[model samples]
Target chain A: MATELIKTRKLAVGYGPRGKVLQGIDFTIERGDFLGVMGPNGSGKTTLLKTLLGLLKPLSGTIETHAGGGGRPLFGYVPQRESLDTHYPLTALEVALMGRFGRIGMLRGPKKADYQLAHACLKQTGMDARANKPYRALSGGQKQRVLIARALASEPEILLLDEPTNGMDVSSEKAIMELLSELQKEKQTTVVFVTHLLHTIERYAHRVALITSDGSLIVGEKSKMLAPDVMARAYKEK
Target chain B: MIELIQVPFMRHILLAGVFVAAGLAPLSVYVVLRRIVFVGAAVAEVASAAVALAVLFQLAPFPIALALTVTSFLALSRLADSQRLPLESLIGMLYAGGAAASVLLITKAPRGEANILNILFGNILTVPATLLWAMAGVFGALLVFQYVAAKELLISAYDPDMGRTLGIPVRAWNMIFYGAMGVAVAIAIRAVGALLTFTMLVAPGASALCLTGRLNRAFLVALALGVVSAVGGVMLSYQFDLPTGSTIVGLLVVLFAISYGIGQLRSAA
Candidate 1:
């Protein structure tokens, strides 16, 4: 087993005074652990992912991670694509370069190395040819690639991607899954991916955490965790 | 016939027009993008109250006007962040409250009715010497700061979360931006007065956007447009003896209409 990278203890996740959507959830992820958060809609899977990334603070629990080098760990986060408004006056290269911000910090401009990283990430994501294009004009699949490049540019130890295959074609999905698998093998990077694809969960992820509507969390291998009875029971509570 | 543009005060108005072109174009662009033109109206109402208080205490209107504009702007922004109250409601309250206060203050003025109408619409070409110096200093600083921060500002305006993730303190940047806008409005009030000043702030910028459609290039176009309108407006005002700010803004409206027509023609093509 690799060293523990993210450890959350009894983390209860929800918005304020709204009551908890997820309660008494505990887990620790190690390097090389591909964890998939699986649940039905409004089952707190997304909220759990958000809680892990510190997007939303847990009402009652502790989430301790060794991110950043003495700063909050810079995780390459692929947020929900639907949440962003892509109609601004930015090019693909400029948007990709934003990922270097955690490394660069405020006030100071992007440096040579930052551009190099952005360029490299774009190449890796097959978005280099469209670097100068307006971001809003890109297709949904291309937009997803740009976002993935942004995450890669951050040089994060862990990648937290939300629905990485939402708008992707089958070939693109295969390409992405292969790339991610290769990245995990080469760098031992831990990925906490949130998706609803049962095949993807069975094929790519090493472990799965199933979140239920009543705030129950189940964590184990795919065979044990993805049984129809287990999934039905997991999603049955509302 | 006297050459008004040749005179220092007329030159100051031209120069101040040039200064406003730097920030107002992008400010207008963002306003249209963020769907927050109502914020501009809110600031204007708050500034009106400050204008009233300035007249009542016999205080110089510039400093007090600027302070009130920034304070109220910051308060509104914070209130927006907290979602404490709906923004439209707050703007309404500010408008009604300020109008009420100013009316009360204007009623108590020792002299006969201060021509509040003049303040509603500015007379730009008649700027005083001290006000000229203040415009030069403030406008110069904004120009340099904006040039350096332009890239970051453009990014933040579109995707604030992306900027935050990238380590741009977008909240702090926003405060600086709106505060600077308030300062610009205050500087404008010295000559054009409060109500009419939005013309200088909004018109040149809007026209530039309609014509060019690119952010950096739009600044140059807006600056040129502002100067042409001011210089041309002053000439017309001198010829007809009309209100200077009205003439300038009127010219701006004409230019905007023409530009909008041309833009539609181009886009349709």
Candidate 2:
């Protein structure tokens, strides 16, 4: 019985009033829960993630995020890799160091301790050797790993990733899944991974939230949710 | 080159050039990263318009120009944050409007046409000591601000979505960066001229980014390129009797091309 980290009750997320893209998103994530959110294109998976991260206002309902010892439940968000422009002159270490910016606060920069933590995070992701490499030079898998490392550097109680394995090769996808599994169990950190990969949701996720085209959400244990009938019901709506 | 430095006016002009370039170079990295290079042009136009109006009405120029420039920057930053229109479209509209207003304002001033040419194509050779000191102060302040706020600014510009998730106050950082750019552009237009200020705000950073894959090194390289371009351009212009501002701009373009070529070659290798 782990502590409840995030609990959403009838959550409605959208761009503005009257523009609700997702509603009735009732779910509870406990400490160390690896939850996978599965949905088709335009199924509001991203909207839900954004809402949970507090990046977007919840159109309706309530979201309760239990605070940790630091007085807030810090969240590390790994946005879709496609969303970032890699052509900019930044190194892997530089990207990882971004995690420390919040804790480092204003007027002061990343000091020695911050850099050490960033390096340690990179090591956790097995990206320490390539830390000096330009971000653009890394392979897609490597880039994702670096991004996850960035998220880890923040020492969040919960990590949220959007489409983390999209476009990755089978080996890369498996590697990412394994790394995420190890991270969750080792750190007791809750993870909300958003993707459309059915096999990954069935295999890696402890719990699954399936969103339908009609804004319906079904959440259950992975084994029950991935049962043929439930998946069909989740995807069949138009 | 050394002979030119012997002249007091030339010395003041060169120092002014260095200050303007150094102040604006580091900022240009964010300008390029955020894809707001055109916003620099629009802000310069607004500064120019303010300057022409101040001169025409016998009001103080720098204060008026700086005020209007900063206000316009804030407005543009807000518009950009809203995501209503594409940033390019907003910047383009502002550029055209500011350009037209600047032309109209300059035409109505006492000694109108001459003032227009001077504002559009400034005389760095005649930089006043007071103006040089002003540039030094502004440049120093910008350097110090960047030193303290570089990481936060970098995080905000690199991936604002990530910044927002971390509760990094992305909007506030955007405002601060734009505010600094406004001051830099306004101060630069006095010596670098309205037309050349955009180049100073973009070229050095672009060139340095082309040459380096690290942000810290890029900043250092940008500052060096800016100083070199200013010093080298002034000497070349003096030696060839070329227009100082345009000469410096041409030199920066050449440096950018060279850097691009080198960067491409390195990537290929």
Candidate 3:
């Protein structure tokens, strides 16, 4: 088993009145481990993922991401495709290269090595040949793959995904999930994935954190968390 | 009529229009894309308020208006950056405040056809030499935005989140763009007047958007359309005995319609 790579203490998630969707949520994942967070909509599962990724701030408590050492954490992120305006003029390759922007800094453009790295990421994600394609022209599956390649370009020590399989047809979803799984198995990068797909939560997640309405995190093993009674309570349907 | 270019006033009118179109057209694209329409109008109202003050105090209207535009931008910059309100809401508030100030200025000024009518509706035919210089200054500001701030501007215009995620400094970019746009408007408002400023700001850019498929292409087409509209509008206005700014705007509307039609057909095909 991989050693602990992330730690959070009593973190709350969400914004405005909806803020604190997930409350007092404490969690951790080891390097090379896959942890899934599952909850009903508005339960703050997605918000918690955003918090961990530094996309959103916790209302209370602290979450420190281990980028490994003093260096900024190099990690991949797969944002929901719908959140992006695919109609933007950038090509898939251009969009993917945006992953390097943090390191590329201002004034200076990306280097050849950066492009090579992006290409390699694309190759790994099976998107190399489609690099020239306009981002909008790509189908939903292709966009997800391109996004995954972009995340990988950062060569992050950890990968954070927000509903990666959503808005995708079953075949596309299956393909993308398989690709991610294959990547994790080979790369040994820590994976923190959020999803509502119960089958995925059951099948692929090594550990699971169940979030209740009002942003409460219930953490445990996947099988333990996936119990119907636990889910019923988490969803508050019982 | 052709020999009138030798006259300084007519020269100022046509030249100021050139400068206004140059800056306003592309700016409108950014405005439309950013979904912040009437930002130019708001800024112009503030400038007009400053002009009214200068007139009341017997100060030079252009210089005073320019100063007020800058002042509003500095204040608005702070307001725009603060998190209490969304940028759009803040700009709207600024708009209302500026209009109130200008209206107060006009109310307090010596009410005359020359003071209110000329300043409010714009004295395009009587535009003076100084307006040309103001146009040059604003055009320089626009160049800075196009080159010095292009990348940041593009990012901020399209996806502010991604811009922030990439650490492009969205706050600074916002301030700079808003400030530059304000400066550009202050320069042109005297020539185009408050009522018709959006015509110059929005028309050429909107027309170009209709004309082109890509961002760069859109901007280039916008520049060309702006120049043509400004020059053509004045001449056509004279030819048809119409208002100068209106004629220009009408021509721009026609171009936009034509381009839209063509783009639609092309898309259909």
Name the best candidate (by TM-score).
2
Give the runs in model 3 whose Cα sits over 4 Å from its true position.
A1-3, A16-18, A69-71, A108-123, A128-130, B1-11, B53-105, B112-120, B124-131, B238-242
Per-residue lDDT tens digits for candidate 3, residues A1-238, read: 2266777898777784443466777887778888888887767777777677666767888876565664335557787889786434567787777777666766566789889988888888889998987787789899999988888886678888889888788889889888878878988877888998888888778888887754578888877887888887677752
- What is the DockQ for all candidates, taken in turn? 0.33, 0.77, 0.31
Whole-model Cα lDDT of every candidate shown, in order = 0.72, 0.85, 0.74
**Clash pairs detected, candidate 2:** none
lDDT of 1 by residue, B175-259 (tens): 7776787777667665566544666567666677667645566667776787787667767876898876677778888988998
The true-versus-predicted C-alpha distance at residue A19 of model 3, in Å, is: 3.6
Best by DockQ: 2
Q: In terms of lDDT, which candidate is strongest? A: 2
lDDT accuracy of residue A68 in candidate 2: 73
Sort all candidates by TM-score, best to worst. Answer: 2, 1, 3
Candidate 1 lDDT score relative to the true structure: 0.72
Query: How large an RMSD does model 2 have?
Result: 1.9
Q: Judging by lDDT, tell me the better candidate of 1 and 2.
A: 2
Query: Candidate 1 or 3, higher TM-score?
Result: 1
Candidate 3: residue B80 lDDT (0-100): 57
Native contact fraction per model: 0.15, 0.81, 0.12
